[model samples]
Target: MASEPGFLPRDGLDRLIEALRRDGREVIGPRVRDGAIVYAPIAAAADLPAGVRDAQSPGAYALHAVSPDERLFAWANGPQALKPLVFVPHELLWSSRNDGADGPQFTAAEPAARPTAVIGVRACDLAALALQDRHFLREPYPDPAYRARRDALFLVAVHCTHQADTCFCASTGDGPEAESGFDLALHEIDDGFIVAAGSDAGAAVLAGLDLAAADQARMDEARAGVEAAAAAQSRSLPSRDLRPTLLERLESPQWDAVAERCLSCGNCTAVCPTCFCNAEVNEATIDGRENGHYRQWDSCFTSGHSYLHGIVIRSETRARYRQWLTHKLAHWHDQYGRSGCVGCGRCISWCPVGIDLTAEVAALAGEGTA
Candidate 1:
């Protein structure tokens, strides 16, 4: 049976947090840290960045205070996403030590994931998480650590009432309002949130919250806010299926144009939620004592990424940038059943140089259809 929708008042949010924690789940939520909103451990709703909003554009982001406001998730987004929670940036796969008489002994890092509940997830991130699942949990060799962490996750999604200029999830058919993949979804309004459950666990949590049944007036208001946020976005991809057209434009001069300003800093791929490239590293002690093997997040923009047989394939910034764009917009469809971009616009806002992919797509896509 479908769970009835309820209005979770501002005070009820605290109770909801308490309920999740009481259920033996550690809560992770958005909070202000180091001049940006970041996902961090939280004990209560008070830990959230209440009344804090953000303004985002190409290569710029700023936080502003909305005084006398009770809104906790009034901001569009921060630098961080749900990627770090499941796909750890740096993880030790295993470590080895030298034994004097015996051979080398290796100790694998045990998957020590605990039940975790994340609040204030946006629709774009939910879509990105789905892609991450597709990449990590594929057949033939699923990532054990990623699978363990993913299994213990409980998602609490929130509709984006406030969107930044860099947002374009509507164009990608991803956001403003979350529809699926979340355990509990929140439709935020001025006074509170209109909440619904997408899973049995979510229904259990909702039932314990003691929230009132959502009324027609507030429900209408919540829908309106989400619609306004979607409509307010000015950026968009040329099409949802940019596979053929982007691939056809591989030799286009637009690559040179973008490379003129591109920094080759790998920030775009680093911030991208769907780009899952990792590099394995091994360290050995000079005294032949011990060795450790680690894996860390990597990016295509790195010059070493294309290293093979003592030769670099994508040596120039232009080629590397082109590879990123084509793979993200075109090649990913073949590999992952859809374009890799979720239109979160982290690449744009977090870019050291203001290189907007929407603008780049507009430049390259001249009268071409997917």
Candidate 2:
């Protein structure tokens, strides 16, 4: 049987944080910085972005003080998605040193266990993590490093009560609420939090905190509030079946139009939480006496991504752009059972040209031009 849901008053959040820390878990959460909310290592509960809202745009983000401190969690997503913590940006797979007599000696660092709790994770990012799990952890050949971090961490998902102009989670059916793949889910109910456990671990946390049980009426109200926020989304993708539609429109001349303005700077892939493609390089001393190999994040926009024998599959800017879009919206489903995008809009918000992906998909679906 499922455990009963619990509620935690907003004032008790500090106690909960301290308890998690006492239990030896490193707690990280959002904090107000220069002019935006960023995920940083937090100690005191006061460091969190309490009573502040963030305004986001492509290549821009700003922080604003709220009136009356109505909803402390009323904020849009952040510029950085929580991907690097799991899929390291760079790592050394193995290193070798010369033991003068022995030809070469190699040692590899085993993946270490991480006991971490990330609070204030947005709904879109939660969905992105689920998508990444399918690619890196649930695959036949799982990534040992990613699996270690994912298994040891606890997720605290937050419902987005506010939406940005670039947000489109509704169209993708991924967010405005914590649907799945979270241990604990929280809804901002005025100054307090309507907390619910999504898994056994979440229930254990709630039990440890000894929080009060949330009544059915409060749960209903919280659900309604989440639905209203989802309905208030200002952006949406077209309703066409993205996989078939995008594959059919691969040569429809729209690729060149988008590529013309796109700098091909690879910002989209970098900000994307589910892009797991990477490349490996081996380095050695000038005399080739010692050597080591390292893995680094790679993107489809790179010229060397498709290199084979002296030929590149996508040499032109337009071809590379088309390949990226098609793979994300079309081929990804065929390869992985789910779309590569999580509707986080991180790609759109980080793009230097303000290239909105929702608009691009709508244009490709023949709804209208971006």
Candidate 3:
């Protein structure tokens, strides 16, 4: 890492990975997995998906290997989001044990976390992280487990020069370019990468690196590439106050129309980076002497998610589907002062029934126009 924005040759990436490891940080990054890019433990820069790209559409996703000379950051968003890394899908909250004397005693479970440096983070994921910070850190009762994982993370954000057909980050005002919330940011160019530090730790790493200073001409080329990516996005939300509009139409027939096509499989919320719903369960042995309490990710689409007093609220698929869409686009604003959807297109790409929220909202507004 240089003291300032600088040029790093392709091989510098391997050195960076080594530098993080030398600092006792576990490095996690995008790698080819089960025909898709998934974040996993990475040992070296070779673990990155160089010259790989993904084809994504509603109900479909496929990865392809491009030219060997292709840039490392050529792929767009993957099915997995940043939520799983920090929020965690499931965790033991506490365990109850009894000695031979008194009743059961409960011991709180702590988060098992390691200092981690995450590479290949995209702009939309950064936005999602910020929103999650507000919810998990700023809430009335902050989640200690989430806080632990979040505090242990070092983000390495990368600019997206490629756009997927399902992406609409431009409309969400989130991406194609990552502007903040990163320790170090990298912009990939033909010759190499333009790297800049956004924090003191990042600056310290850069100061020890053997890299050349980036010139204005190189910066200009990188800006052009990002702009081209933004323009290439074919999908976008309508330029209007979507929150108020969607709220007003809570009773719209469009909800039923969309529910007809929805599978209620919870794939949208599962892939969503900002969906924070969860449920807690208490499991006990057949003897009923000890109990294990655990928390797991839950989806609003489940029939039992809203169960209360021997009856289920939002019993119909239409109501559950409405809860998901309205909460994502409308109610999230009231709760977080921002939209939950980062426009990364994971929801669209992973949906089994190909239900696009952008299209559903368009239908509510009348001619189904973009």
Candidate achieving the largest TM-score = 1
Which candidate tops lDDT?
Answer: 1
Off by over 4 Å in 1: 367-370
| Candidate 2: Cα lDDT at 64 | 81
Of the two candidates 1 and 2, the one with more favorable lDDT, higher being better, is 1
**TM-score of every candidate relative to the true structure:** 0.97, 0.93, 0.96
After best superposition, candidate 3 residue 290: deviation in angstroms?
3.4
**RMSD vs true structure, all candidates:** 1.8, 2.1, 1.8
**Native-vs-model 2 lDDT?**
0.81
lDDT of each: 0.91, 0.81, 0.87
RMSD versus native structure for model 3: 1.8
Ten residues in sequence with the least summed lDDT for candidate 3? 361-370
Better of 1 and 2 by TM-score: 1
Error of 2 at 281 (Å): 2.1
Ranking by lDDT: 1, 3, 2
Q: Which pairs clash (backbone N, Cα, C closer than 3 Å) in model 1?
A: none
Q: Which lDDT tens digits does candidate 2 get at residues 111-193?
A: 88658988898888988887788888765799898888888888888888788767888888888887888888888776488
